[model samples]
Target: MNSDRLFTRFAIGINAAWLTLFALVPIILILIVSFLKPDPNFFVLMHFSPRSYLTLINPIYLKVFARSLLLALITAGCCLCIGYPFAFILAQLKTRFKPLLLLLVIIPFWTSSLLRSYAMVILLEAHGILNSFLLRWHIISQPLHLLYTNTAVLIGLVYCLLPFMILPLYANIEKLDLRLIEAARDLGASHLQAFGKVIIPLTLPGIISGTVLVLLPAMTLFYIPDLLGGAKSLLLGNLIQMQFLYTGNWPQGSAVSIALTVLMSLLLLLYLRLIPKAQRSQPL
Candidate 1:
């Protein structure tokens, strides 16, 4: 028993050390740098200043932040709507077929996401396969302007993040007690009613998990907007990248990063608090 306890403690210590070295240290450095002043020649100076944070109050930066938040919410909501039905279908499949279906969901990971984004670019272009097919079918007189738009960026976000939304929902739905759904049906609850009242409540955890997984990354995926939305859809991720890489303002970039991190952390905490109340309120 003592040996088991000692081993567990050692494992925890090792994990803590790894997290401190990689995650905590980098976050601490970024936080510290955010408070420093940027130099004209150098990226930042040793002195402290609030200029970076103050600059965020500018309407331009506020617009970028708002755009990013809206895009993330839309992407997450789209994923949830598309994924829920697909996950439900998957969860109802036979055990023998389940692995194959899951493998199909995961097969996209073998290819680079960059490559996938580029593929979208090709498909969404004016003279692309989709347009050509539509033209051949007399769907439109000319090729439509499909690429380099917010719609294209949304397509990329949904295609990439759909799996993240589906897998969690499938896991949760697969474990659900189908008998409860049957009971609700027997008690005269209609299909939609049983789904809304019982199945949804049981899958709330998975919904939250999937939303967080998709929303956070969707907020910062600059490459997707770069490839699909072009300059017209400049997002917060692009703004931060420009600050650090192009403009050579590391302090401002760090400040933006800190702001994003704090906002997401607070949102996550709010979700955590509300989830329990939501679950408890549902009639089980």
Candidate 2:
């Protein structure tokens, strides 16, 4: 028993150390950098200022923030709508082929996201497969210009972040006690009523988990917009990338990064706090 206790403590200590060294250290460094002054000639000047945070209030930066929030919200909502149904169906399936269906979901992840973005470009381009198929079918007189639009960006965001949403939801849904659903139905609840009173409450944790997974990434995935959406719109991720890589403005970049980290941390805290409450309220 003492040996087991020692092993548990040792494992927890290792995890704490790992988080401190990797997560806490990087965040502290970024926070410090966010307050530093930018220099055109140097990486950063010695002078300290809050100019980076101040710059975030600029109209252009505010616009980017708004866009990022809107896109992330929409992406999460879409993923929930898509993923919940998929996860529910996948979880409730009893066939021997269930694993094969789940494998198909995992298959897309095997390909590089960059490669998939390029594939989206090819499909979305004017002379590409989608347009060609549409044109061949006389769907339109002319090839529709689908690239470089908000719709295109949303498509890319949803496509890439969907799996993140689905996996978490699946994990939760699979553990659900289907007997509760059956009991609800037996108690004269309509299908919709049973779902509303039964499935959703139990799956609240999964919904939150999936939303966080999709929402956070949607706000910060730079390449999908760059490649698939033609860089017409900039999200927070693009803004951060431009500040650090293109403009060499590391302070502003760090500020954006810090802002993102704080936002993510808040989401995580909420998720952690809410899960227990959800579990407590869960119908037995």
Candidate 3:
């Protein structure tokens, strides 16, 4: 009994240490830095100031924040629309072939996300394969301008975040009790009614999980816009990147980072409230 107790305490201690080192420490450091006065030559001054947070209220930065929020919402919505149907189909597959279908979903992840974004660049370029094929079929008199547009950025985000949406949805749908659907049907629920009243309620957790996963990353993945949408399509991620890397404004960058983290936390809390009280108490 003592040995098992010791082992459990040891595991807890290790996890606490890991969280302190990786999560808590970084957040504390960023919070501290966000209040520091930035110096162009020295990076930051020891003096405490709220200038970094004050700068966030500027109209230009507010616009960027709104744009990032809009893009993240659009990306998450698109992923849900695409992923739900795909996940439903996947869940209906035979047990023997299910692994193969899941493997296909996982295949694209083997390559770096940056590499995948670059590949989109090639495909969306004016004279790229899509446009060339369209022109060959006389679809248009000239190649369409597909790259360096909001559409391109949306495409890249959807492509990158699709897997995050699908995996959670598939897990939830796979665990659904089909008998409950049949019972609902026997009660005179039509196909759409059963789906709306039964399947959707049961799968709500997965939908929430997938949306949170896609939305958080979409808000911060600046590279997709940089590669596909160009400088004209700057988002909050780009703003943060420019502050730290090019402008050497650590305080402002840290402030942005903290703001984003807080926003995500609040959003997550709101999403949790939508879950059933019982489910909220259970493991995700």
Model 2 alpha-carbon miss at residue 272, Å: 0.7
lDDT of 2 by residue, 1-284 (tens): 99999999999999999999999998898889899999888979888999999888899888888888888999999889998999999998999999899888889999988898889889989999999999999998799898888788888889988888888888889899989989999999999999999999988888888888788888888888788777878888888888989899899999998888888899889877878864534221
Where does the lowest 10-residue lDDT sum fall in candidate 2?
275-284
Cα lDDT of model 1 by residue, 153-253, tens digit:
99999999999999888887888899999999999999999999999988988888789879888999889999998867778888888898888899999
- Sorted by lDDT, highest first, which candidate order results? 3, 1, 2
* lDDT of each residue in 1-284, candidate 3, tens digit only: 99999999999999999999999999999999999999999999999999999989999888899999999999999999999999999998877988988999999999999999999988989989889999999998899999999899999999999999999889888888999999999999999999999999999988998899899999989899888889687787888888999999999999998999889999889787876766544333
Q: How does model 1 score by TM-score? A: 0.87
Ranking of predictions according to TM-score: 3, 1, 2
lDDT of 3: 0.91
Give the whole-model CA lDDT for all candidates, comma-separated.
Answer: 0.89, 0.87, 0.91
